[model samples]
Target chain A: MIYFDKVTKTYLDNLKALDEVTLSIEPKEMVTIVGHSGAGKSTLIKMLLAEDEPTTGSVYFESVDIHSLKRSLLTQYRRRIGIIFQDFRLLPHKTAYENVAFAMEAAGRSDEEIESDVPYALELVDLREKIWNFPSELSGGERQRVAIARAIVNQPDVLVADEPTGNLDPMNTYDVVQILKKIHDLGTTVILTTHNKGVVDSIDKRVVTMEKGKIIKDVKHGKLTL
Target chain B: MMTSMKRILRAGFLAFWRNSVVSVASVFVMTVTLSVIGSIIFTQVTLQTTLAQISDKVDVNVYFVTTAREEDILAVKTALEGLPEVAATEYVTKDKVYQDFRTRHENDSLTLQALDELEENPLGAILNVRAKETSQYASIAQFLETSDLLKKNETPIIDKVNYQQNRAAIDKLAAIIASSEKIGLFVTAILVVMSILITFNTIRLAIFTSKDEITVMRLVGASSAFSRGPFIVQGIMAGLSSAVIALAIFYPLTYWLAPFTTDFFSGLNLFSYYVDNFPQFFLMIMGSGIALGSISSVLAVRKYLKV
Candidate 1:
C-alpha cells in the first residue's frame, strides 16, 4: 500500500507541481491518474518512487517515509516498485532478454532463477520470440512489451506506468493496456498515469482527475467523465 | 560479491564495446597525453646529459710569471685542489706548453721559425683547474683574483689568468642552457595540466553518450556501485589502451631517432635510455593514464546517477 499525506512540491519559479494532495492505494488495486499537461500527475508518482522529495508533509509506503530512507535502504525499497516510462526506457544496447534480466540482476537474482524466470517474464508479455532482438529492431508495441517484461521480471509489489502509452499508436496503446490489465489481474498493484480518455474508459476502474496542482475528483468505478 | 563484480565488469566491457567510436576517441586522446609526457621526460634526461658534457669541457687556465718559482706554482695548484668546488687541477710546465704549441703549429712554417728564433721559452707554467659545475667557475676565478698567487713581495707572481679569454662565451652558453631548461620545465607543466583536462572532457563526453543507460539502471533499483562500476572499468581500459599504444608507437620511434640524436649530441643515446628505464616509464605512463581516465569518469557520471 502507498499513501500521500498532504504532499506539496513547489519549484523555484513558483510552479506548484503538486499541492496538498492526499491519496492512497490499497493492495492489488488498479488505479489511473488522469490529467492534462502539468496536472501534477507525474510529480505524485515521483514522490511515491522516492525520486523527488515533497516540499511539505510526507509520502509513505507501508508505513516507511519514502523520502527519509537512507540511500542503500531507499534502493532496497525501490526494488519492490517497478516503473515504466513513456519512452520504453529499455537499454538500447541490450537485447530483449537482457533488458528483462537487467531488473532481476539489479535485484541480485541467481543465474538459475534468471535462466528460469526471464524467459517466463518475456513470454507473459508475448515477447518470447523477440528475446534476442534489440530495441531498435522491435516495433513500438513490442518495445513496450519488453519494458513491461523488464518491470515485472522481479515481481515487484507495485507497478507504476507513467504515460506508458504516450508514445504508442492506438493499436499499440490498446495492446499495452490489455497487457497491463493482465498484469493487474495476476495480483500486482498497477498505477497508470495517462491523458488518453480511451484508456481510462477501457479500464473503467478507480480514477483520480486533476486540474492545476490539486486532485479535483476521485471516483470508484469511474468513467472518463472529464 | 564475486558474481556482482563479474557482472559489473562484463557490463563495463559491453558498454565500452557498444560505444566503440567514443571509446576509441577517448583512447586516442589519452595516448596523445601519455606520449607528450613521455617525450618531455625523454627530452629532460637527454638535455641533462648534454649539459653535463658541456660543463665537463669548461676549465680555467692560469699562467705563472717566468720569474715565479716552481714551489710557488705548486702551492697554487695545491690551493686550487683544496677547494670543494674544484674537481681537478693539472700543472703544465713551460717546457710542455712550448712543445704543445710547436706540435699544434707543425704545418705552419712561420710559427715554427718564429718559435725557433726565440732565445728562451716565453710561455709560463700553466695551472688548469676544473670546477664541479659551470656556475662554480665564477667563485674559483674570484678565489684566484684574491689569492697571493697573483702578488708576492710587491711583484705579481702570476702573469695572466686565461679565464677571461673565454669568459664571455662560457657565461653566454651557461645562461642559455639554464634558461632553456627553465623554459622546458614550464612547458612540460602546462602540457600536463592540459592533458588532464582533455582526458577529463573526453571521458565526460563518452559517459554523456551513455546517459540513458545510467538512468535506466538507477530506475531499475540498481545500486550505486552497480551503476558506477562499469564506467570505472571502462575508464581504466581506455587509459590502459592509450598507454600501451603510446609505448608501442614510441619504441620504434625512439630507435629511429637515436642515430640522429647521437649525431647532433655525441654519447647521447636515447634508445638506450628508453630501454634502461623501460620499467619506470611503463609504470608512469600506465598509472597516469588510468588515473586520468577513472577520475574523469567518476566526476562526469556523478550528476546523472542521482536517482
Candidate 2:
C-alpha cells in the first residue's frame, strides 16, 4: 500500500536522516519498525506523512507520489491514514468524546456520523466510561487510548503508531499493544515504530530493523535485535 | 458545509475560552489602542469646534475720520460688504462709538474722565468688517488700505484702521491651530502604526503559546481550515470584545465630561457630538478592531500552519 523509492534526506549541516533507503509495505499487514533514536525512523515516518520532503527519489501512497499532491489534496489524502504519537497529542480542553469527534470533524464527517461513531470508537479503546474526561483528567494510558480512538474514529485505511507505548506503564503498554493487535485483526494496515524489545517480542509480527539511516533487516514474525 | 461552519465557529469559541489568559491579554491591548484612537478623535472634534468659535471673534474694525460725511462712510461700508472675502460689514456712527467707549470705561474713573475731556465726541465712525475665513482677514485689510476711502486725495475719508492691532493675535491663533492640526494628524498616524504593530506582536505571542495545540491538530489530520479557524475566531472575538469594552468606557467618559467641556469651551457639547456620531464611531472602532485582530492572527499563524 505504500512505497519508498530510494529516498534520501540530507540536512544543511551534513546530517543524513535517510540515505538511499528504499522499502515497501503490503496491504493489511502489521509491521513494526525497530530502531535506535537516530536510526531515521522519525524521518521515514515524516516522509510518509508528507511533513518532510525526500531530498532525492520519492515516497508513494498507493502508487501516488505523496509529496507531489497539492496542500488541499494532501489533506484529503491524509484522512485515509491515522497517526498515533508517544505524547498522545489530545487537545487538552476536549473530552475524550470531543477529541474523537474532532478527528471526524477534521475529516469533514457528518455530525450524525460523529455522534454515532465516536462512542463506538471510544468503546473500542475501553474508554466509554471516561469519555467525558478531559486529557488532563485521564491517566497516560487513557490519554493514549483516547488518541487511538481519535485515530480510528474516521476508520482510516492505514494506522501508524509512532512510539505509542513510550510513555505508558507496563500494564498500559500491554493494553496498548493488545489494542494495536486487535486493530490489525480488524484488517487495518498497522505500521508501528518502537525501540522496545519486550514489546516487539510479544507481538511476533513483521519487523523492519534500521541502523543509522539504512534498513538492516526485514523479517516476517521476527524478534527485536540491535 | 453548514455543519462544518458551525463546527469551525464552535471550535473557535472553544479555543478562545481554552486560551482565556491569552485572549484576555489580546483584548486588553486592543481596548487600550481603540480607546486612545477614540480619545484622539474626540479631542480633534472638540479642538476644531473651539478653533472655529475663536476664529469668529477675530475681525478688523475700520475707523473713519470724525469730519468724514456719514454718506462717505456708508459708501465705504457698502463697498466693503461687496467684497467676496468680507462676510459682513456694520457701520457704527461716532455717537454710538462714544457711548460704547463711555460704557466700557465706567469701571475706571480716569478713563471716563479722559473720554469726557475729549471735546465734541472725537471718536470716529467705525466700519466693522468680518471675513468669510480667518486667513482672508489679511487680504481684506490690504484691500481696505488701497481703497479710495483711505487715500482720498485731500482729508482721507478714513482714519486709522484697527486691523494691524488685532492681526498679530489672529494670525498667531490661526497659525497655531493649523500647525497643531498637522502635528495631531502626524501623531495619529504614528499611533495607528504603532498600535497595529503592538497588536501584531501580541497576537504572535498568543499563537506562539498555542503552538503545541496547533501541532497536535496537524498531526491528527486536521486541515488548515480546521486548525487555523479557531485562532482566527479567537482574534475576532478579542477585537469585538475590546471594541465593546472601549465603548462602555468612553460613553460614560464623554457624558460626564460634557458639562465641564461645554462650560470651558463656549458650549461645545462633546457628549452630544459623540452620541450623534455614535454609529460611525461604532463602525470605526469595531471594524478596525476586527481587522487588526484577524490580520494579526492570520499573519502570526502562517508559519505554524504548514502542516
Candidate 3:
C-alpha cells in the first residue's frame, strides 16, 4: 500500500511539477496512471520511488515516510519495489538472463537462487528462449520483455513500470500489458504510468487521470477519459 | 556477503571485457602516468649519484710544516675525525709527501736534483679532510682555524689549510646540489599531479559512457556500494595491467640507457640500479597505479550513483 499526502514538487523556476496531489493505492492493486506529457505522471512515480522529494508534503509506503528514510534504509525499501523504464534500461552488454539475474544479485541472492529464479522470471515474461541474447541482439519487444522479467525477478512487493510500452509496438505492448496483469494476479501491487489510452482501457482496473500537475479523475474499473 | 562480492567481481570483469576499447584506453593512460613516475625516480637517483661524485672530488687539505711534531699532527688528525661533519680524514706522512713530490718531478731532472741536494725534506705531512656534505666544509674549515689542536706551545704548527683556496668551488657545488634538489622535487610534483589529473579525466570519460547503467542499477535497488564496487574493481584491473606494462617498458628502457648513463655518470649504471632495486620500484609503481585508478573511478562514478 502507498499514500501521497498532498504532495507538491516545484522546480527552480517556480514551475509546479506536482501540485498538492493526494492519492492512495491498496495492496495488490494494479493502478494505471494516464496523462499527457508533462502531466506529472512520471513525477508522481519518482516521488514514490524517492528519486525526487516532494516539495511540500510527504509520500509514504505503508506507514514510513519514504523520503525521510536514510540512504541504507532507502535502498532496502527500494529493493521491495522493482522499477522498469520506457527505455528498458538494461545494461546493453548483458544478456537477457544476466539482466534479470542482476536484479536478483542486487538483492544479494545466491548463485543457486539466480540460476533457478532467473529462468522462471524470463518464462513469466515469455522471454526464456532469448535468455542468452544481448539487448543489441534482441528485438525491441524482446528487450521490453527482458526489462519486465528483470523488474519482477526479485518478487518485489510493488512493480513500477514507467511508460514501459512507450517504445514497443502494439503487439508487444499487449503482451507486456498481459504480463503485468498476470504479475498483479499473482499478488503483487503494480503501479504503471503511460499516455496510451488503449493500455488504460485494456487494463480495465483502477485509473488515475492527471491534467496540468493535478489529479483530475480517479475511477474504479475506469477507461481513459482524458 | 560472499555471493554479493562474487557477483560484483563478475560484473566488473564482464564490463571490463565487454568494453575492451575503453578498458584499453584506461590502461594506456595509466601506463603513461606510471612510466612518468618511474622516470622521475630514475632521474632523481642518477642526479644524486652524479652530485655525489662531484662532491667527492672536493675536500679540505691541511699541510703541516716539516718541523711540526708528528705527534701534534696526529692529534690534529684525530680531532678533525671527531667532528660529525667530517666524513673521513686521510693522514699522509712527511716522508710519503716528500716521495710524492720527488715522483712528480722525476722528468724535471733539474728540480729533482735541487730537491735531492736539499739537506732536509721541506714537504709537510698532510691531513686530507672530507665533509659529509659540501655545505659543511666551511664550518669544518672554521673549526680547524679556531681549534687549539693546530697550535702547540702557543705557536702555530700547521703550514696551510687549503679550505680558502677551494672555498669558491665548494660553495658553488653546495648551491648546485641544493637548487637541483629543489627544482627536481618541484618539477616531479608538478609532473605527477598533471599526470594524475589527466588519468583521472580519462577514467571519468570512460565512466561517463556508463552513467546510464549506474542510474539503472541504483533504481533496481542496488546499494551505492553494489553499484560502485564493480567500477572500483575495473579500476583496479586497469591499474594492475598498467603497472605491469610500465614496469615492462622500464626494463628495456633502463637496459638500453645503461651504457650511456654509465659513461656519462662515471660508472653509475642505470640498468644495474633498476635490477638492484626492482622490488622497491615494483611496489612504488604498482601502489601508485592502484591508488590512482581506484580513487579516480570512485570519484567519477559518484555523480551518476545519485539515482
Candidate 3, residue B257: lDDT: 99
The TM-score measured for candidate 2 stands at: 0.87
Candidate 1 local lDDT, residue A76: 92
Correct interface contacts retained, every candidate: 0.68, 0.60, 0.77
DockQ of 2: 0.60
Worst 10 residues of 1 chain B by lDDT: B148-157
Model 2, A3-32: lDDT tens digits are 999999998988999989999999999999
Residues B1-307, candidate 1: write the lDDT tens digits: 8888988888888877876888899999999999998998988888888887888888999988887888889989999899999999999998999899989999999989987898988888899999987777888889999997667787888888877888897788779778878988898899999988988998998889888889889888999888889999999989999999999888998999999888888778789889998999999999998898889999988978897
The regions of model 2 sitting more than 4 angstroms off are: B62-136, B140-161, B255-260, B268-276
Q: Model 3 scores what on Cα lDDT? A: 0.93
lDDT at A114, model 2:
91
Candidate 3, residues B106-204, lDDT tens digits: the string is 899999988889999989999999999999999999998999988888889888999999889889989999999899999999999999999999999
lDDT of 1 at A31: 97
Best by lDDT: 3
Better structure of 1 and 2 per lDDT = 1
DockQ of 3: 0.82
Q: Relative to the unseen true structure, what is the C-alpha lDDT of residue A193 in candidate 1, on a scale of 0 to 100?
A: 97
Q: Higher DockQ: candidate 1 or 3?
A: 3
Model 1 stretches astray by more than 4 angstroms: B62-99, B108-128, B146-161, B267-272
Q: Indicate which candidate wins on TM-score.
A: 3
